[model samples]
Target: MRPLSRRELGPLTGAAVLALAGCGASEAVPPQSTASAGEGGTTYPLVLRNGDREVRFERAPQRVVSLDQGSTEILLSLGLADRIVGTASWTDPVLDSLAAANEGVPRLADNAPTYEVLLGADPDLVTASFGRHFAEQGGVVTRDRLAETGIASYLSPTDLDDGQSVNGGKKARTTPLTVDSLFQEVRELAQVFDVAQRGEDLVADLQRRAREATEGVDVGGRTVAFWFANLDTPFVAGGKGAASLLATSTGLRNVFADQAEDWPSVSWESVVAADPDVLVLGDLRRDRFPGDRLAAKEEFLRTDPVASVLSAARAQRYVALHGAELNPSIRYVDGLAKLGAWWREHGQDL
Candidate 1:
């Protein structure tokens, strides 16, 4: 699975590793919880809100049905592929090693699995991400409806809550979606499978590598910008999210670190005005690549004038990533390392 690219981490760009809320057997899921489940000796009860419905996991789901790419990645990472009986949408290219296994697991549905297909799968647990992926989005099966059918469900923390505030006190958003959070999710799932030790080992290895990659120089004064796909329509990374976190951890400065929300759209002029020292490029549609990004950057410089004067482009140093990694999951960490490596090679002091 591709990790969230450095370009994806827009605003919440920082060095400190973001932590996932650890759930164990001791953490009893609240009444009408958002997520709940158990496997081996552990239990994962959901504690998240999904619009009007609350999501939850009830027990260790042996017959799992994953509805989102992020959930699929998480399940597969924990060596629980055997538990997954089905999956859906934008997941065709992933888990190549499990090709034969997937052949039998039935594509749950097209972009969004139908309620009938989901019920037919006979899944003990159903996990989804986007609202449309669930019945709540029209005829789609709502989590509550799934529960009524004796199925448990969990929504990725990122998709469950948008870190918005209501009724005064701010509601917590998905537990920090970064490499560290990815590790925690892996660990939590491992516990569900009675493989906590293995989860810890995996996390340790990843963190060790990340630390080595980011060893140290200085970054307080450095400035960078993460550009996703369209250079003409600047979709800048924001603070308090994966892309920004990766940049800061790698010891580079995110130019859009001041942005309020994560992964918000911006303008071409903004890029020119920001004039970041380094700009990270994410996957662009194949047709748009080479021409689109190049033309966009050139045009920006031509019009803004100040843009051409930036050191980042003058040095011809930019990091490009596949679209897959932009999604929040274990792959996000890999993206971080790749970007850090690019920075190190391109004269980033760190």
Candidate 2:
């Protein structure tokens, strides 16, 4: 991607900021600055506490490899598209507003890139939303391995505190996640890039949009279930992920909030037992799983003997959300806005 002009790098305002809507906190606290501010207000040899690891940056990274779509979008939103050399693990198309900036970046893989490919990109820093991306085994590469090559790495704070197990086990969140988690990530990334002011502006814009979307919208007694991709065993949202944030923000109760895992695979019988008031389905573009597509999920709900009995399915009370939006990312606010609007317009009738 070409270097963003001064105008483009300036604080996003009005519609330009709104257009990006089309696309959480944990064990690791907000990045703690260990040194005084240097030139440009960011001190060199900056140390950021990432989970249990500490990432030090001697200078602003010129080339960054974003290992997940969430991280990639964050970088693009910060006007650091030019700094991104490679991206991977995309679940959906780039946000409409970010497509142009992302066009020039190389995609290392549709999923996780191999260690060799990641290193070949020659990136100074790599960022990922999932800890599995940096796992020692069954992962692309580990943080220690990257450090051996002098390549710095950053993991989302939400994935810290052993909430995310690297052995492909179910992810569990000890504390509930919220949009503030995402804001923290943006702020930390901006600090890393020496663009603290831009981070503040973006955070303020996101906060405003979130407030506007949820203001005075109360669907207190309503309950909902978030269905991600799966057929035999559906992966529904648990208490501590993005779904929890959406539910809490809009005053909707999550049927599966009792489960602590982020996404738990439960039988259709269990879903019927919960019998939520609304079904928030993930409209994913990737077809890696049997029910990855929106239509497939909808079809299963309408045809399956067990699933077809659901009240939400019978009433057609479904809220379709982008798969990316359901994850911990900037688009989560979009999900909140959509859910609140749907509840205001249609939820009362049900």
Candidate 3:
């Protein structure tokens, strides 16, 4: 997406400044210089590295707004539903699935809100799943600008750009998307919201589920191609991401597991050469961008110029998964279970 022009930023920036000035210390709580224990014995004035910046939570956020579904779900899982004031996304199906938990939460925007609109919520903290949520392409309120105003932010470890420098010029950690990395986000956020026990408990449960999912699952030497998104060319889940982690649990191997990128685009010729035994089509709805629908993607594989004759396509060995589920978040364990179950039943045939 194209970034907004400087001319577009001037007025919105002014409105945001006004909104910040209007907040009487309630909406704009500055990070404290000292740390102390708070609710449920969670340490306060907590400082942690989230994505590319240092975030300090002086106290539990009063008016929290989730900038994406991943953060929204994480907040809810930690029993912070009452703390959330606003949410924005491109029709997050995960939030939709947890509709009862998210009932009455303010729907801020279908995508990232403008600076004026974001500030109107009087939010103390804005949590996001991806760096793009704070991207200039989205609108005003970049993390640095928000920090100057004492409003804090967070970015999921999985969402930071791999090449970007974070926290004292260290390159961002953006690979081998494992369950521990996902749970670390939960534990870290749990600390942020003063819900350490709940976070630990969730992490333990996910750990147990993942263990059980992988236990006794035989791969039968069937390599898989986790097709993330594409129309003509396939944008695949490379070896170092969530898809590969899930594949490990199911005893299957990822054909694209030799790359450094978390998710890498590959030619169908590569797919042909790899000759994966199974396919995992990530089903994405066309909410914001024109997403590649599951049905359409399957059809393309069966009828396209190159993909039509691929072994995985002809065999019809596809494990359909929600695009959102594959994102490194609370649902990662669910992904393990889903793939484990599907492959156990279907993958045994080949």
Candidate 4:
């Protein structure tokens, strides 16, 4: 829910608004078909309002370039990997989760690929999990520029319109993401590919699993806290977005459940005040944050005079979560499964 930070954007740094993919959403083009003739504007021109701009896709694109792991993962799940010619991401867990789905896809760069490199790929469609992916990496290559070359661009619903906010604006109108919203995105892709059934089946399965995972779950009685990264103050999963949803599913109450935003910067005192039963950490490499590694976070909690006294820390009740799995994507189900198991195993013990 902490919109992938500008720090995570790496090469696209300094351009915050340019890259957030799901801050807002684009209105869909008209209804679609499996294969429509690319003739008159009638069924050919698929006009969609993505975020703020209107994107028109003359026909289903055969070649797509994905900008980040989230977008790339979604395409692979939709069975659209064959259509992706290039992919680049600051972090990539697709290989671990999707496995063979992206076996042959070329990695363009660790960060955003240069405009020249993108053009050389000759992609018919460009998909990005964040808005920065559409912006100029080295040379200017905005969605408008891509359109000039007859290329279509699509932003995942994860990075939809935020309605002209100063920053990440706000979390989805529906705080913490809902399964329905997730299903809606799957459906949108189905429309984009004109492969309606595949999308529906995927959504239905996800819905069933999510429901079952959370069904009869009542964590309202327990206390949970999520630790993302460190600064002068700690950043926490602020009672919203994917983290909150996962906490609910696992029957653990979020200690930061009062904050309305997805992720928030809270004082160490506040964390101590809440006294969470357990602490969930989003683990990453040493290079990703100032104090980035999982061990570093644990060390801080154990050494900090104030933090060391918390009940969870006293018991060393920490659940390590891969940073990528913490996002609102297909891998989320894995978190649901993991968190549920963690509670069943430790909830009573804690």
Estimate candidate 2's alpha-carbon lDDT, on a 0 to 1 scale: 0.80
Predicted structure with the largest TM-score when compared to the true one: 2
lDDT of each: 0.57, 0.80, 0.69, 0.66
Kindly list the per-residue Cα lDDT of model 1 for residues 185-231, writing each as its tens digit: 56755664556667777678767776776676345556788766454
The deviation in Å at residue 53 for candidate 4 is: 3.0
Residue 189's lDDT within candidate 2 is 93
| Model 3 lDDT per residue over 271-305, tens place | 98888888888877654333367878877877777
Residue-wise C-alpha lDDT for candidate 2, range 1-350, written one tens digit per residue: 78643224322211111101001221222344334564347875566766655676656878889999999999999899999999999889999999999999999999999988887787778899888888776788877666655677888765654534421334666777767768889999999888888889889988888899998898976899999989999999998887778888888889999888888899999999999999999999998889999999999989999999999999999999998889889888788889988988897687
Off by over 4 Å in 1: 1-39, 43-59, 89-120, 129-141, 158-180, 217-220, 230-232, 284-315, 348-350
Instruction: Give the runs in model 2 whose Cα sits over 4 Å from its true position.
Output: 1-40, 162-170
Error at 78, model 2, angstroms: 0.6
TM-score of 2: 0.87
TM-score for each model: 0.66, 0.87, 0.81, 0.77
Q: What TM value does model 1 have?
A: 0.66
The local distance difference test score of model 4 is 0.66
**Which structure is stronger by TM-score: 1 or 4?**
4
Residue lDDT tens for model 4, 1-350: 65642224422322112222333453333354324743221244455556656565545567788876766777788788788899886443563757787888998987778887877676767777656565444322677666545566776665453532111333433435555555666776666666667787777777777777666555556788988777448778866566777776667788887776556788889999989888888776435555456888888888989988999888998888765566567667777766766766776785
lDDT value, residue 79 of candidate 3: 82
- Top-lDDT structure, candidate number: 2
Badly placed stretches (over 4 Å) of model 3 are 1-36, 90-92, 95-97, 136-140, 160-175, 287-291
Point out the higher-scoring one by TM-score: 1 or 2: 2
Q: Where does candidate 2 have its weakest 10-residue lDDT segment? A: 14-23
